[model samples]
Target: MKKQDVSKCALLLSLFLAASSSQLVHAEEPVSDTASNLATNVAEKLPSADMNSESSDINVTTNQLDATLAPKAEAITTETSEKASSEASQSDTMAQTPVEGQSLNLRILSTTDLHTNLVNYDYYQDMPSQKLGLAKTAVLIDEARKENSNVVLVDNGDILQGTPVIMAGKYGDHLGLIDLEITFQNGKWSVNKDKSHAQIRKIDTKSELADASIVEIAKEAHDGTVAYVRKQVGTTSAPITSYFALVKDDPSIQIVNNAQRWYAAKELAGTAEANLPLLSAAVPFKAGTRNDPSAYTDIPVGPIAIKNVADLYLYDNVTAILKVNGADLKEWLEMAAGQFNTINPSNKEAQNLVNTEFRTYNFDVIDGVTYEFDVTQANKYDKDGNLVNPNSSRVRNLKYMGKEVTADQEFIVVTNNYRASGNFPGVKNATVNRLLKLENRQAIIDYIVSEKTINPSADNNWYFADTINGLDLRFLSADKAKDLIANSKDIAYVGPSATAGFSDFTFTYMKPDQMTSMTSTGMSQADRQAIHQLAAKVYKETRSSGQMQASLPKTGQKQSTGLAILGMTLVGLVALFKKPRKQN
Candidate 1:
């Protein structure tokens, strides 16, 4: 053939042979980028002129090229497919490796509400407790760290006296052996007058302790002293005072009641009510030392200590300010009034003044408003703030500064975060104007520190309605309450109660004006009519069973008297105030 044709044929044959020879020798595979570059160079080198002149020779050479490289191409394609499958399998293995977990194990060590119990010792009981103290927890923490290289330790606040008094109250009351009534004098708990009722005592509330998930710890710690149960989740502080004393009907002994009100009045009286001061109120539970109000008693009208502050404000609830209308404010008090069971005027048998099911912590008394709860009528809301008796009107004579509160009139109320967060009926729709950084308990402490001396005297802003003229109500309180009960017309101290460390007291219904407030107990025309009808109905129903079976929402009943009072209609009130309840 011609020289150019022979050169073209030689070049094509050499390229094909080189490719085939590489595959035959099992040389390193050419990467995709390198193979693409080689093909581009080979195409550039082939001239169009040479291809035209050497068509016949190129056809003969192409046949030989295809025959020789066909096997190599097949082998290369097979090997490529196998390599791609292997790579795909490796990628899948990597993707699934995370699901099998890691080599290192992580451990978390945590404790909370230590309450300054650093040593394995009980300061109040004067005893050693192996179950409490950070020192005891340290050993376990070290063990945890040693077992796992990846470990974290965390403490969840409530240091010092920031611990809640309600916890101590529940523990003491449920155990029924801890002396919550022990007074503070000379920087120590006052010695029990009755030697048998000592501060340090054994507790056997097995069911309660177990339900609390601290039975084992309590058993180990309770050595003739208050339980010093310590665990990772929750811990208890030393009980310094009575938790239930704050909610006592006898405002005289209610140190916490006046303290909370006084704190709000002094610190949280917002600028909105500057012309006419705002009221501070909270719904604190009566956990212990519930008593009768017969005689008046003061906190010696002297300087208060920091320790006493813990008794006044029991929880860690932060302060919150709510701008509410008079109507909703009255409704708030009505929800609080649910703490008391309806008192049947006609019932002769002894009836409980306070609803045991209704937690006393919900009974809110506005410091600036004078209100009376007519127990003769049904409660408007349940303990959870559900409107059970849509037509029932229990809140009566609700007035601010001797004037009847109007629906349109706005007022500021000082309360805690828990109360302000739409937890109760009247307060659910109230606008939270501001939330303060100070906790309720811390505020009380600060107030005492600022004042140095405080007189926690109740203004008797709230009381029961005088409509039940002569119903003798019976309530239980700590035995020490007997000393404070003066022989008054309204209250009479009964003998020791069957319950250990408790006493019974008889309280007769009387006018609020007779006791504290000079403001007349005037009733609206609607309240008078409702009261008359209720009295008549109770008289008829209670005569047979000596009990007025009023369908109160708190009692889980669906029926109610639906009595209308105070001209405050309940139309659309439910929809206006309904909100999702939160767990405390």
Candidate 2:
């Protein structure tokens, strides 16, 4: 063979080896992703598309599945088969299979404790390839579900109290969820009022110690000592006020209610000149003690547990069923018992520092479970690398790892993802089961791009006492709503879950997550008519029997209030100003 021919043969062999080597790895063709880079290039030139929009084409789609199913315009499906990888290692396993009897399997993609990772959670790279966002993540979920028969998208929790996304939402421009945390408690060492009441007490919630969680209380002077549970994740410097959940005092209401008693960090820290804004409902030990609201050494604000945002369960826009996978049910009871055990009976002799209402101050029960969270210890890291316990051991609030023990029976627990990953240490890998990861994570964008129109709606049923502006705003946690869905077993309602997140708010009439812009109480003329019709249908079914509510989707609500309020306000103002004033 000629020398040149030999060289060519060697070159071809070298190319073959390189191709084979690719099978062992997913070569990060860092330069290949042109959309985001191009987008960045265009961003400075133009404006950013809606943050929720997966595709630049924010148009409508006739078939919801189309947009949800389509991959990126440039995504090569045939190439994917060629790209099927053995990315799974001993540490993690990845699998994909078509469900039996269906061309597509129902895909459920979940991400918990995102904590405001609107951008890639890793802050190293300030670009798309390095970030994980609901928008980018939405693409993955959309594609996976679109490729399968049915798909469910879920967010585990802590969605509102972390990162700039949440922080921006909370303080408007001043703060976000990522900026919230408890700095100090002023009265952590306040002395007990009397000997009979004791310095501390531990109580049981009617459950086994091993099978239960506990609640503890530290006694202090007066009837209105405040107990506060601050937002664990937010601005670091932000001070958390103590709170009390109020419903236990109201005997007339038999139903569940979450109220609060607010205490400033200064009071908990045993300091005067208290700079913390003590916006709470804690009456002074003596009713007339707090005469000033602003600079008064003492005042009252919230008990944090108050349903002031709305009526009990109404904050979710509807009543949601909660499912807790408790092992013995007595475990929580034991935690309470531990608190009752801390009572120092001798404190009863104090002349001025007697707290007469100590027994009355307890956890606001949901169903039968009661929990009193430790605000101070929550921020401190313990030797075991867990949140330090601020409260006495008798009453423990936070659960890290196996401490609080979840039943894992597959139901909602009314908590955000931060607590799910044992408080966000890395929950995605905590308990892996049958998880359906998205194929491209951008399939929804492709589907939406494939079609032109979009209908964002869900079938979660949320019956309530009434609606505001003709719609209800009360809501339940996603966990509770899910219970009403799978186990509610109402033959009337089909596969829909029961939820409270989407009452009077305007929903897209499609999936809650799919909506680009929904009002707080998604009830537009378009949505109102739709929700009204749905509410009417579900209401009728609920009245008929338990089975009726079972058929509805438990997650019909979307908490995204971005455009819902604006849309309603604009429409209302237009209607108000557009009216021709009557000529007298």
Candidate 3:
């Protein structure tokens, strides 16, 4: 072959190979679309010389190229077409197959702040309310579930307390403390033994000695560890009154046994809230109520009924959880510290322990963190969370797990929706993790039912710091302090005050460490000595009332002291867990 003819053959071969590669790259198209176009392109590009010239050599080379590449092009086209078809089939199968880890859709249902309205009925107005009750919410929950096959339910708290309906029935009769009139017979003082008779019915002095003295008789009555003598029921013309032994657990006997103080203790509400997410809680309370001294709930500890739950949590606030830093936690405590009045450490005259102007509900005690308020220093914030005294700080030794809480250390705090949104200092701007659908009261009830027997004991996590040095701190409480002061190491009965139905109690604030040992199960030497003096004083007062007698009552004939049981009940509260949901 000639050199020029050889170069033309090589160029034709290279062009055919390039066109085939391009056609295969877009092989999804029909074979007829490009296969004929490749042949026509090579023929057009050849020089058009007449019969026996150099162009005839090019034409011969093109004919030779077509012969050499035809079979190869046909094979490439067939292979490309089959591969495309197979890929299309595979894609169709893939589209129809179920994914192993596909996401799903889920719906969350919630209700909160039921506030003792378990049913639709309202006791105060004596009518059924459509807007009330957790039962009513069940229908809505069902509808929500139907909309989404995957669903979850949650509650935010504040279900137990509030609503006069909860207070109008049997639970309304809070038999706080029972005063049993015991007489010394055969050198042994005795009172009623049966707890049922001891609580509702009056002490039958006529009956034989069940146990020695009021304390021993009270200890034998296992129905409740405490007894309270409710001074007077609100506005009842014929209110029952009695003198009952104020046992340690008896809320009515103490001068200050209200929901605010009771739930603030670490054992009851604190433990319940903490246990939900296994985190700390910052529970708040007011210093006073609309009813003041008359507004008190004292439920017995024996059998927990529906009415008892109402006495514990006194609100309709929904539960909430906030993620806050330790510094913010401290600020929240500062706002709560406004509950107390700044005391002059050097003053000898008695001063009020609490600020009467501060609302009780605003006072928050953060459980799981050990802290104290130095009442001697002015409060850093007012009840409304406004910075009152910028230079002053009352919260001292704020700690978590025995270590000082760092400014940026994060913590999850359980609280009600009211406090979370109320713009309280440190808590107002907190990052809310969840706003639950559950009521606070219902949470308490659920917790009670699960535990069966609850011991609402104070862990003494917080207290006033060193108020006993030369400061004659005093606070007003129920007149029942006369019976309870003997056992208390921090409180001294200071006689009846001018305020009707109230008494003056000297607040002998002890060091936190001293408090544990002094108020322990076993009495201290000082406690023993104080008890002896207090016993004589209580005996003389009893004798003066003409209630105590040396002679025993006629055998088997029970005597009524005109003391009726006061209505009291408690409810548990707070905390809910998150349910896993499908993403859809």
The models' CA-based lDDT, in order, is 0.43, 0.21, 0.40
Per-prediction TM-score, please?
A: 0.48, 0.19, 0.44
Q: Candidates ranked by lDDT, best first?
A: 1, 3, 2
Q: What lDDT does model 1 reach?
A: 0.43
What's the candidate order when arranged by decreasing TM-score?
1, 3, 2
Error of model 3, residue 216, in angstroms:
47
lDDT score, candidate 2: 0.21
**Residue runs of model 2 more than 4 Å from their true location after superposition:** 1-253, 257-309, 317-328, 331-345, 348-364, 368-584
Q: Write the per-residue lDDT of candidate 3 for residues 1-584, one digit (tens) a residue.
A: 22222223233333332221111000010111211122123223432211111100001011112221111111111123234334433322222222323222322222433243444433322344443343444444444445443332323311122311011111111111111122223332222222111111111113332212322433433223122111111121111111111111221211112222122222222223332212334332211242133334444335554434434455666556677887888988898788777777776766776564566567665555678888889878876678979999888888765678898887666567887777788886576556554455544544344334454434455777765465776655566536645666767877765444456666676776665454322322233223323323333333223332122111112222221110010111111111232221
The number of the candidate with the highest lDDT is 1
Residue-level lDDT of model 1, residues 466-533, one tens digit each, is 77667667765566666654545566777775444556667776665465432122332233223323
Ten residues in sequence with the least summed lDDT for candidate 3: 22-31
